[model samples]
Target: MASIRISCLLMGLLTVFLGTEVHSYAASFGSLAHTASATATTTTRSVTTTTRVVRKRTWATQSSNKAFNINMLDMCHRYGYNVDGQFVVPEFMKLLNALNRAQCHMASEILYPRDYCLSIKDEDKVDLIVIGSGTAGSLLAAKLSDNRDLKVLLLEAGNLPLMTSEIPGLWADSIGTEMDWKYFAVADETFGQSLDGKKVNVIRGKCLGGTTAMNNMLYDRGLEKDYLYLESIGLTKWGWKYALKLYKKSEDCKFEKITTSKTVKNFHSQGGKVSVDSFRNTRTLGIRQSFSKAISSSNLKTVDYFDVKNHRGFVSSIAMIKNGLRLNAARAFLTDANRKYNLRVALKSTAKRLLFEDNKVVGVEFENSIGELIKVRVTEGVVLSAGPIGSPQLLLQSGIGPKSLLNSLAIPEVAVNERVGSNLQAHASFLGMIVSFETQPLKAYSISEMVYEYLLKQSGPLANIGLSSFTGFIDVNEDGTPDVQIHFYYYSEDDTVFMPSQLDAFNFNDNITEQIIDINENNDMEIVGISLLHPTNSGNVIIEKTDNGYKPVIKYGSLHEDDVTTLLKAIEWFKKVLTSEAFEKYGPKIVPLKIAGGPEPNVDSEEYWKYAIKHLTTMNVQMAGTCSIALNPSEGVVNQNLKVFGVENLWVADSSVIPRIFSTESSAPTLFVAEKANDIIKNQLGCKGSNESNEDDDENENN
Candidate 1:
């Protein structure tokens, strides 16, 4: 009887959860959902409408929702819903289930609510197969598909992003959701000591837009020198001038300051797919202004991050957002019309391995949504855009890594590229350095009120991340290039409950988080992160085949002395900002974050900061260089053309091909690669399709 009750409870919970999800999507996509009253009125005999018209309308109204309802009922029945089954809390469950059913039923009537893309039939062949519709693949597939003559297939391991992802502030909510790949770095004793399980959560977006859908919407193109290293390494096309051109091509610069600036007028572009604009929330403008003043007071000029002449300064960030919605890579590139013919997307399809005919990649084998293994042939080639982690993991799984590892695993070696998963690099940032202010920087509002405000005006905290959008770059060593990037997030006094601790955004331990909450309850706090752009140490990714599938073993975070020294200098730089007249007015002071196994050290001492630096550093998730671009096979997995060595028609166009980690967010660079790859692939395919499209062009879009 107890077992039956437990089973019934779980079944009811599942129904409620799934039902709630459907309603939430409906609320987010208000324009899509149909009204039940309208449906009922249409069904009834209305004097205003003709009988024939009513019948036609009713027939046309039935959609995927009908199938969803049937499937939902079957799922409930299979989970132990029966007339004869004795269950506890029957009345409550029955009431809740009734409400949920009604809500879900209404939600089902919505048209193309989820990511509705063209499905791939078994054994189908395409001109090109772009694996992983991530940051790069999404754009690459769309660009390649523009020919309308060549069939392009884009495979995504995860489904479409939820409507909540459109809100910039809700980015953290998707970290562990179905949208996230949920890759965790191997636990390290040297760092992540205060986090849960001593492990750092490496967030990689699994959905159509890839990490672009789930990450903070900052749109930063690194310094010009960042790509000079690539040019110096024989990748001449990837020089600063060409890289900036590609960035401009992909960007629809909406910021008036950038679009109208005479000095930077040529640096930005219009009519691009990705919309770059300031955060929509007006409430944060005051705080950002204060920060800009504070930065000036610290003797650092406030310059445009996009200006070619500038290398170090504080500036209000521009993000991949327009109005109030996130313009992720998929949304920017893969439009519904694109799927009408040449372009097709297969969601929830995980590419297992590459199928090679001799030395050429001919096709791919992947697991479908229903756990069925299927093979799809490609006429042209395969582009591996599965990101730094996924790309390396797939390569190793296909026996393209070191021969010794493949031999031990008993997998046949496809190639002997020892560098397939080596040279992994990322920006390291310490998260524990914090500052408390005497007054609240910004007022905290309730979720319901914020939602209402956003729905009505499209302006609120939900539309932006407040002062967090203010980012800084510093040339710590006085070199021409910036070595450190500063990112700070503000927590309003009243935000103690609904903050990082509750969301587990950083995976901090309960004790450490609670300490933060205690401090934040009365005083507004700023968590300043100093990112080390250039690190001497590097790590690698290895894959092990499991009964389920291949699991990525990420051996990362061995910080070098140089990295630590740079971070120390950054700490001093930030301290000057705190002491500035603009910030000094707030009576700001450093408050070291509490760590486990501690009597806290003196907050002002260098020793205390060193300890904090050692324990608090975390990856910025701008990971790259696992399958670096080099001159030959011994040095890297891919060459300057991004083609894998010893293999024909197998290209990599993601961060995996980045020769070096740069001092900025990875999104823009990844997109630049996609733009470059589009041209390369077009040149290789001998297609004459143009890459440029107007913003209002209706031929293809992701919406």
Candidate 2:
């Protein structure tokens, strides 16, 4: 009878103690058992207290052991333990891997002037018009708007930032909503195509923050030579010096508080504006050793490049974060202080066409907040930040494109038919493999009692941006210049590079998206992603079929042999990465990996693979090149300052105007155009930059 009573007590107690998807405070045998006890003995020197002992005992019931093994990301990363920037080190990639996706869904939607700021639009009037509220635009707008007289009109087509945006796991939600300007790429012969040719989607934020709000927030500036290439291609002012200024202007780097390089510590500012560090308590010894071996074997060095101009090494990734949250463009530009003044932010409104008088740009026609059609006449000037895809379409609708294409659309030929909408570029990204292992998910924070800490203490997993970190750079070409860049992001759960039906399943939003994740059911898992930059194949953006208005038709021109080579090279590299010692031992099994020793999946060969990849490959959605720049006005569509040739008071300051494409996030460069173009326009007008222009400024106004 006594034995039976003891067994009943043990059964009742075991049931009471269980670990949840998130940590639970209730005392249970899981932690007091094998794994937890072993970790405790090693981590905690000598046991002191006895009154509240761990209740050490190996339970006969296997249920608790099974539950304890579920989704251990919180426990594994040591989340809910640190304060003032203390965290775990080895599993940083796990955190970064989770950040690979851009989440477009919001728990709740906020209203703005346009459907969302997924695409860029011109706020192009002189000292005021702010183009793109993403990383750079927001900072510029907020700081510039500081001038009392400048009645800034901050425009974004995307939804405002939400509380959930601060949560790292739901990152993919940044891509789909009203904010994403889902531009499709023109189809090519490489990928499997529809009888009706398929275009890969190029998404941009139509919201105030622009892409910065949606991006993973890894701060990477490619090789210095990329800028020099710009000078060779028609952008003389965009050389290093000019580019450096913009970088300085946009960042208030806070390296002291971050777990990164001294160069980053010294070069970047913390107090200036955008909060830039989320890699605290990460960067473990295990991770460092693994990456060092992996990158080194690949013949790459690990060095700090943030402070130096020309750097090479595997440096820790920098971020634009604040208290473990993203400091997006809107946060920088659209401030509460500015909103109090005449700075009006209109959301959900898309600029349709530029209203013109003969050869002069007069104002802009647009669909308002409720999708109402309206016209805003700018007696001063009109700026075009409609990005690469939308801006060109806008110009064409406003009568500014190639004469041949315009004649085909039957739109009245307005601006002298120039080379607008020519050079389109972007990066191609692929999911690697989904890992299901006895591993932690990437949020991997290191704190004691993490869940409760985030819930009440306001310190824990919630305070960390989920990501595994980032790396890769422009590969050296035979000419001794780096030409392409790539990044490998490791996560605890993803399938970035699978087969066709698998690719569709991973890349698109299907019924799987509707199914909520049961974190409790998943543990010992990981995910990997690899991205290829500097795509060679150029595409075209034409006006969609319409008697009036300009809806764009995009083609994913990915047939260039050079692009095929780059994609294949990057894929091969990822295949090699999966075999590294650390991963081979602890990482999930990589099946059918195309590396040296792997079981054969179904198909092989360039022709078969090209067909597979072409149909499989899609743009990272970093779209650019439509209204290209030219040193000689006759050589390109827009002039050096991105002004449409022979047009009066009209300019395009977005990716579309970039004459040549560089390999990095395109938004940063696009914002730089807005920055420099604003100054150039002011100089041309000979006006002291301000919203209310001087009498002399009137002459410079387009009309």
Best by TM-score: 1
Per-prediction TM-score to the true structure, in the order listed: 0.81, 0.71
Per-candidate clashes come to 3, 104
Off by over 4 Å in 1: 1-119, 496-498, 501-503, 690-703
**Best candidate, lDDT-wise?**
1
Candidate 1 accuracy as lDDT: 0.71
Q: lDDT values of the candidates?
A: 0.71, 0.51
Error of 1 at 192 (Å): 1.8
lDDT of candidate 2 over 1-703, digit per residue (tens): 2233323332332332332222322221123322222112210112243322221222222334444342457554543332344454343434323222111111111122222222324443423444345544454455545555555555555555544354443344555555667655555655424211344556666766777666666665555656677787756667665655555555666655433653334334345555555355352335555666877766776554343254444566666665445666565545454344645565665667777888887776666666666555555465666667767877888777778887887878786555676667666654433444455424443222332233232344334433344455535443444444544333322221111112232343221111101111234333344445566667777786755455787765565777667666655665575568756545554432232122344333444445445544556656666777786655667787667787887776766766556566665565566566656665665545433111232211110
Candidate 1 residues 120-233, lDDT tens each? Answer: 666888899999887799888877888877888888898877655666766676777889877888876656767766778888999888998888888888776776677778
